[model samples]
Target: MQNLGKADKTTDEIFEDHLLNFNTQQVNATRLHKDINNYLRCIRAMQTANKNLMDTLSEIYEKEWVGQDMLYVQAQNNEMLWADLAHKLADQVVTPLNTYQAQFPEMRKKIDKRGRKLIDFDAERHTVQQMQNNPNRNEAKFIRAKEQMENAKRTYEVLNSELHDELPALYDSRILFLVTNMQTLFAAEEVFHSETSKVYSELEAVVDKLAKEVQKGTLPRRAYNRPLPIANHSAPVIQNSSSMNSPPKGATTDNLPPGVLYKVKAAYKYQAEDVDELNFEVGEIIQVVEYEDPEEQQEEGWLMGVKESTGQKGLFPANFSRPI
Candidate 1:
C-alpha cells in the first residue's frame, strides 16, 4: 500500500505546521536569484555602453592633439578594467547565488513526497478508528488496520523529523551566503576602483600637459570641454597701514614671497599717486600676499598687492582687480 499510489480517500483535516519556514525561504531565494541575474545583466550592459563610447573617442582623437597616443592607451585600459570587474561580479556573486538556488528544486520535490506520506498516515489512522467502533468488529481486519497505522506513523515521523531539523539550518545558511557574497562583491569593486583611480589620474596629467602645450604655442589651441586648472587660493591678506608702505624685497613671480594667497587679474590701469601706491597697465596679474600684522585694519577698498613681474608691493584699489 505504501509502495503503490493507494491511500484511503476520506473527509479528514490534515494540519501541517512545519512548512512556514520552508515556504518563506523558497520565496526569498527565488527572488534573490532573479535579482542577481538582473544585476549581472545591467553590469554587462554598462560595460558595453562604455566600450562604445571609448571606441568613438579613439576614432576622433587626432594626431595633432597633444597626448593623442596616450589618450588611446588609457582608453583601452579603462575598457579592460570594466571587463575585469564584470567578470569578477559574475564569478564571485552570480555563480554562488546560482549554486544556492539549485538546492531548492530538489528540496521542493522531497516536500511534495512528504505531503503524500502524510495523507497515507492520516488515512490509516481513520481506518483504525472506524474498525474500533464497529459493532461486529473483525479481529483480523482490526489487527491489519493497526499494523498499517503503525507503519504509516513511523514513515511520516522519520521524514517529518528530518525536515524539521533541516529547515532551520537551511534558513540560517542564508546568513553565511549573504556575508560571503557581499564581501566578495565589495572587495572586487574596491580593487577595480583603485586601479581605475590611477588610470584617471594619469589621464588628468596628460590633459594638463596638452593644455600647457596649447597655451605655450607648441600645439594649436582647440576648444576644450573643461576649464583650465587654477592654482590653490586662500583668503586675501590683511595688512596695517604702516606695513603697506614698502614692497617685500626680492619677491618675483619665479620666486614668489611666502604667504602669497592667490593671483588677481588687473581689470584696469591705475597710476600711482604716492610711493606706497602701485601702478599697473590692464591685464597684469598681481599676487595678493598676507602681511605680518594681519590683526590691524587698513582703510576698506584699498588692498596692498604685489606685481609678480616687478615684485613691487603697494596699495591698489581693491575694486580694480578680480580674483582669477
Candidate 2:
C-alpha cells in the first residue's frame, strides 16, 4: 500500500521520516533535561554560598556581645536548613530528573533496534513473495522465512508499544516535576527568611539597647582608666570638694594644670617624708590628675597627683582619699 502524498517513497523511507520526527522530540526532551540539570547546579551552588555566609557571620560574632549566643544558634539552624533543602532537592528533584534522563539512551537504542527488525521483517516477506513464483519453490524454505518474519514483527511490536507508552508519560511528567521542585524551593526559602528575620530583629534590639546605655553614660567609656585597689586601705573612696583652705608653697592653682580631674578629701592621715610619698592630714583635699609618666601610675592602688592643701606633687595611695 502507498503512503498518502508519498507514492514514490518506500516503506523504509516513510519509517525513517517517522523516526526522524521521534528523534526531534527526543532532542527537545534532552534539552529539557539539560535545563533542569543547570537549575539544580545553580541551587547547589547557592546552598554552599549561603552556608559559607552564615558561617562567616557566626565566626565574627563577639562572644561577650549581646545576642551572640542567639546568633550562633541561628547560624547553626540556618546551616541545617540549607542541608535539609539540598537533601530534599537531591532526593525528590535531582535524582528523579537524572533517572528520567538516563532512560532516554536506552529508549533510543530500543527504537533503533525496532527499525532494524522492521527492515528484516520486510526483507523476509519480499523473499517469500519472490520464492512463491519459482517453478521449483521449496515449501520448507517458505515456512522458515514466514516464521522469521513473524518473530521479527512480534519483537518490533513489543518494543514499539513499550516506547509508545513510556515516552509520552515521561514527557508529560516534566510539568509536574518542575512545579513540585519550585514549590519545595520556595517553601524552604520562606521558612529560612522567616527564621533569620527573627534573629536579625533580636540583634537590632541588642544594638539599640547598647547605644542607649552608652549615650546615658551607664556603659563605661572605652579607653578610660579604671581605679586600682590599694593594699593599705580597705576600700577606694569617691568624694567631691570645691576648694582647699590654704595652698602650700611651690604648689599654686596654676601649677596644678587643667588636667586635674577634681579634688578628693583624705580618708586617712598619712605622714611620710619619702620623696615618692605625699604627706597629708585627714580632711585635706588632693587634686587628682592624669599621670605625666604612665610607668609611675602602674603601681597598684597609687595615683600621682598634687596635694591641694600643700600643692606638693607626689604619689599617694588611692584608697586613702575620697574623690571630690
Candidate 3:
C-alpha cells in the first residue's frame, strides 16, 4: 500500500511538471509569434516604401518624356511658321523693287528738262557781261539784249525753283517710300531668323535633356513615343510566422488600396536670383489631402486655453471635433 501511494504521488508530481512545462512552451510560442509578426510588419513597411519610391520615379520619368516630346512638336510647328514669314518677306522686297524700276524712266525725263534750263541761264549771263564791258554798244541793241537776259534769268529762276524745291521733294518722297519698305522687309526677315533661332535653341535644350535621361537610365532605351513594360510590381504585406515563408500564389493588384495617379512631365531649370533644376512646376499636383480647414465659434476662455497649448492666437471649435 505504501509503495502504491508513493508511485501514485510520483506520477502526479510528474504530470504537474509536464503541465507546467507545456504551459511555459505555449507562452513562449505566443511571444515568438508576436515577435515574428512585428518583424514581418517592419519588412512589409520597408518593401512598400521601396515600391512607392520606384513608382514615383517611374512617374517622374514618364512626365519628362511626354513634355519634351510635346515641345519638340511645337518647335516643328514654329519652324513652319518661320519659313512662311521668310517667303512673305521675300515677296515684299521683290514687288517694291519692281515698281520703282518701272517708274525710273519718267523720272529721268524731268531731270533732263531742268538741266537744259540751267544751261540757257548760263549763256544769258555771259551775254550780259559782254555788254556791260563794251563802251561803244548800241543803246537799242543793249536794251533788247538786257530784256532778253532778264527774261532768261527769270526762266532760269523758275526752273531752279522747280528743280530744287518741287522736283527734290518728289524724289525724296519716292526715296523715303523705298527706304521705309526696305526697312520693313528687313525687320520682317530679322524677326523670322530670330524666331527660328529661338525655337532651335529651345528644341536643342529639350533634346539634350531627353538624351541625358536616356543615358542615365531615367528613360527607357527606346524611341520617345514607344511603349515599354514596367518590371517588378510586387506588393508587400505583413505575414504570420506560423505560415510558410513563401508568398501566396496568384496575387493580383486588387489586394492593394486605391492610390492616386499622376502623369510624368518635363524637368527644367527654374530661375529666381539663382537657377534651380526642378523636376516639377508650380501648377503640378503633388498630393491629395483628406480634409481642409474649417472655421467655428467657441467660448473666448476655451479658445485662449487651446491657443496657449498650441502656441497660436486663434482657435476654431471644429479643431477639437472628431472626424466621422
Candidate 4:
C-alpha cells in the first residue's frame, strides 16, 4: 500500500504523525465536552439540593429569631454563586470545545479525498511508465499518459499540501485551547467558592447569636407566674442545689414538656458530659418525658426528661433520681 504512493510521490511520514495527533485531539475534545456537561449537571443538582435545604431552614426560622433576614439574604447569595458558575463554564469552556469539534467532519472528508487522489496519481504514473518502456509506443498515447499523470499529481499535491500545513498547526493549538478554557473554569470556581464561603460563615454566626440570646434572658423561652431560684447569675448553668436533695413543693407541671409521666427529685448531682445528656443539681425537679425512639427505652434505667430549673431536655440516668 505504501508503494502505491512511490509510483510518483512517496507518502509524507511526518504528515501521518501529525494526522495521528490531530485524531487523538479530536477524541479528547469530544470526551472533554461530555465531562464538562456532566460537571455542569452536578453543579445544578447541588444547587437544587442547597435551595431545598435553605427553604427548609427558612420554614424553621421564626421571624422573631436573630438573623432571620440575614438567613434569607445568604441563601440568595449562595444560589447566585451556583448559577453564575454554571453559566460561565457552559459559555466559556464547553462552547469553545463544541466549535472545535465541528471542524472534524469536514477535515475527515478532506483527508479521505486526499487518499483517493494519491491512489489515482500512482495509477497514472504507472501508465506513463509502461508507455515509455514500450518500443512501439504511440506518440499521442504517450503524450496523453504524461498529461494525465501530471494532472493527477497536481490534484493529490493540493490536498496533501493543505493537510501538511494545517494538521500540525491544528494539533499544536490544543495546548493553548486547553490552558485558556481551563483557566476560565478554575477562575469561576474560585470566585464562586470564595463568596459562598463568606455567606456560609455569616449564617453560622447567626445561629451562634441565637443560641447566646436564648441562653440569656433576652429571649422568652419560658414565662410563668413564678420564677425558679437562680443558682448562679453569671453563667449558662441550668440547675444547682441550695440545700437538701429535695425539690420545692407545688412546682408547676404546666411549664414542663409534654408527655410527662411524673416529676422526680434529683437524689444526687449529675453533671452531663455529653450534649445529649441533661445536667441537674441534687434538689432540682426533673420532669420525665417519653423517649424519642423505642430503642432508647430498652437502655438500662435511662430516661429522657426536662430539668425544671432551666428547661433543659435530654437523656438522664434514672438511677440518679427518684419519683416525688
Candidate 5:
C-alpha cells in the first residue's frame, strides 16, 4: 500500500511539472510573436516615409535644369525599387511570420481544453486512490474512475506531446527565417544604391556643366532675351576714344561720317559688350574707319568699324570681318 501511494504521488508530480513547462513555453512564444510583429510594423513605417521623401524630391525638381527628363526617370526607378523591396519583404518574411503566428490561437485553445481534461483526470485519480483505502469500496465504481483517468491522461498526453515537439522546432526556425530576411533586404538595398548612385552622378555632371556655362556667360540666345538692367552710378564704365561716333581729325573725305575707307562682311555672330560696340549677325556689312593714330594702324589683328545696320562704332577682330 505504501509503494502504491508513493507511485501515485510521483505520477501527479510529473503531470504538474509538465503543465508548468507548457505554460512557460506559451509565454515565450507569445512574447516572441509580439516582438516580431512590432519589428514588421517599424519596417513598414520606414518604407512609407522613404517613399514620400522621394516623391517630394521629384515634385520640386525644376524643369529648366539640365537632365530634367533623366532626373524624373531616375526618381521613378528609385520609387519602383523601393516598392519592390517592400513587396518582397512582405511576401518573403512578413507573410510567413503571420502564418506562423496564426497557429498560436488554435494551440492556445487546445492548451486550455487540455487543462480542463487534466483537472478531470486528477479528480478521477484521487477518487480511485481514496477507494483503494476503503475497506468496503464498490469495485465497479473504482474500475470506472480508473478507466476515466486513463482516457483523460491519453488525451492530454497527445496534445502535450505534439506541442512539446512542434513549439521548439518552430522556435528554432526563427533564426533561419531572420537570417534569410536580413540577407534579402540588404542585398536588394545594395543593388538599389549602386544603380541609383550612378544616375545621381550623371545628373550631377549635367548640373555642373550648366553651372559652368552660366559662369562663362554662354547661355543660348533665348535664355538672355530679357532687357539688360541700366548701370548704376556705382558701376564703372570703360571708355575708348576710338569707339566714338565722331571721326578723328584727318582731312581725307573717307574720314567723314557715313564715309568709309573700306567695307567688310561679318563671317560669324558677334556679341557686343558696351554701348560703343555693335552686335552683328552673320553676313552683315561693316564700314571700316581709318585709325587716327598712324601708330594704331600697326596693330594688324583688329579694325575700327561701324556696323552698316546700326552705325555703331567699335574695334572688331579683323579676322571676324572679311574684306568685301
Candidate 6:
C-alpha cells in the first residue's frame, strides 16, 4: 500500500516560515543573555581576585618594616608640643616663684632647695591676681557708692515731700475755689430766670385785662350828641305791670318778642381813650339775640349807642334783629 498521508507542502511551508522566524529570534535573544551573564561573571571574578591580591599585598607591605624617618618626624612634633607646654607653664610658675623669692626669701630658698612647693605657688599667684585686679578688694569704692546712694535718696525724699505733700494742698484749694464760683454763678442764673418769668406772666395778665375792657361798646349813635361820661348804674324800674310779673308761666326768651332785654350790669369797657370818653355803665339796655341752633344755647346780644373807641369798632351778631 502507498503512504496515505502525503505532506501538505503549502500549509507546512507557511507554518515553517513562522516557526523558523520565532526560533531565530528566541535563539538570538538567549545567546545574547548568556554572553552578557558570562561577561558579568568574569568581570566580578576579576574584581574579587584583584581585591584579594591587593589586600594580600597591603598586609605584606605593612609587615615589612620601613625606615624610622616617618616616626622620627612624629616624635619631633611631640617634643615641640612638650617644649611649648613647658615654656608656657614655666612663665606662670616663674612669676609666682620670683614673687616668693622677693617677698619671703626664707620660704623661697627652702622651696628651691627642696623642690617647688605647690602651696607657695598657689598662694603667690592668687595674691598677684588680687593685687592686679583692684575692684575686687576695694573699700573706698564701697564707701563712695554708699555716699552717692544716700545723696540720691535724700534728693528723692525732698522732691517727693514737695510734690505729694505741698502741691496737693494747693491743687485742692484751687479746685475748691472753682467749684464754689461755679455754684454761685449757677444759683444767680436760676434766680434771674425765675424773676424774668414772673415779670413776663404779670405783664401778660395786664394786657389781657386791657383788651377785654376795650371790647365794651359805649359810642353814641349819630357821633354828634354828647355821650354821658359814664352810663347809669341803677337798676331799671318797670312801669308796666306785665313786665313786672315775670311772664305768664313757663315763657322763655325763645317765645318772647324782643327777647330777654336786660340792662347792662356795669361799665365794663367803653369808647374811651384812657377813660376820658363815654364808658358803658350799669343801666344800658341790651337786646339779646336768640340762638337759632338749639344745641348751643349760648346767648348773643347788642348794646345800643355804646360806641367803640377811635381805632376800634363796635361788634354785633349778624342776625341780631331778625325774626326768630
Among these predicted structures, which one has the highest lDDT?
Answer: 4
Superposed model 3: Cα runs more than 4 Å off = 1-79, 91-116, 128-151, 167-194, 216-324
Best by TM-score: 4
Model 2 residue 308 lDDT?
A: 69
TM-score of 6: 0.22
TM-score of each: 0.60, 0.55, 0.32, 0.64, 0.54, 0.22
1-324 in candidate 2: lDDT tens per residue?
A: 223442232244544555665666567667867886787688788879977887887787555555667767766776776677667766766677667667678867877787777666666666776787887989898889888878877876776667666656655665786677668767866776787677567657767876786678676323434344343446454321223223322334544457775566787877764676788888898887766655454455566668866788886766787655
On the 0 to 100 scale, the lDDT of residue 55 in model 2 is: 83
Between candidates 1 and 4, the lDDT winner = 4
**Comparing 1 and 4 by TM-score, which wins?**
4
Clashing residue pairs, backbone N/CA/C < 3 A, model 3: 63-264, 63-265, 64-265
Positional deviation of 281 in candidate 5, in angstroms? 41
Ranked by lDDT, the better of candidates 1 and 5 is 1
Q: In model 1, how large is the Cα lDDT of residue 192?
A: 89
Ranking by lDDT: 4, 1, 2, 5, 3, 6
Question: For all the candidates, what are their Cα RMSDs to the real structure?
Answer: 15.7, 11.3, 48.5, 12.2, 14.2, 57.9
lDDT of each: 0.74, 0.66, 0.43, 0.77, 0.64, 0.36
Provide the global lDDT of candidate 4 against the true structure: 0.77
**lDDT per residue as tens, model 5, 13-86:** 55456556556655765675677567657767876886687678667756655565776776677667667756
Off by over 4 Å in 6: 1-137, 167-179, 210-324
Model 3 compared with the native: what TM-score? 0.32
Kindly report which residue stretches of model 2 are placed more than 4 angstroms away from their true locations once superposed.
Answer: 1-48, 133-140, 203-324
Task: Report the candidate with higher TM-score, 3 versus 6.
Answer: 3
Q: How well is each residue in 1-324 modelled by candidate 1, as lDDT tens digits?
A: 434646444322222344676678779989988887888899889889988987897788777787789888988999999999999999889999889888888877877877788888888897898789897999998999999999998998787778777766777898899899889989998998999899889878888997898788788544322211222234333222445434323223345547665567776677777786789988998887655444322354466579988999976765566666
Higher lDDT: candidate 1 or 2?
Answer: 1
Residue 160 alpha-carbon offset, candidate 3, angstroms: 0.7
lDDT of 6 by residue, 176-234 (tens): 54454345434544554565455445535544554554465422122222223332334
lDDT string for model 4 (1-324, tens) is 446444455568988898899889889988988888899889889989988999899888987788999999998888888888888988887888788878778888988999999889988988888789999999998999999999999999999999998888888888998999899989999999899999999999999999999889486332211222323233222222222123324333555445775688787777776788888888898887766655445444466788888988997766676666
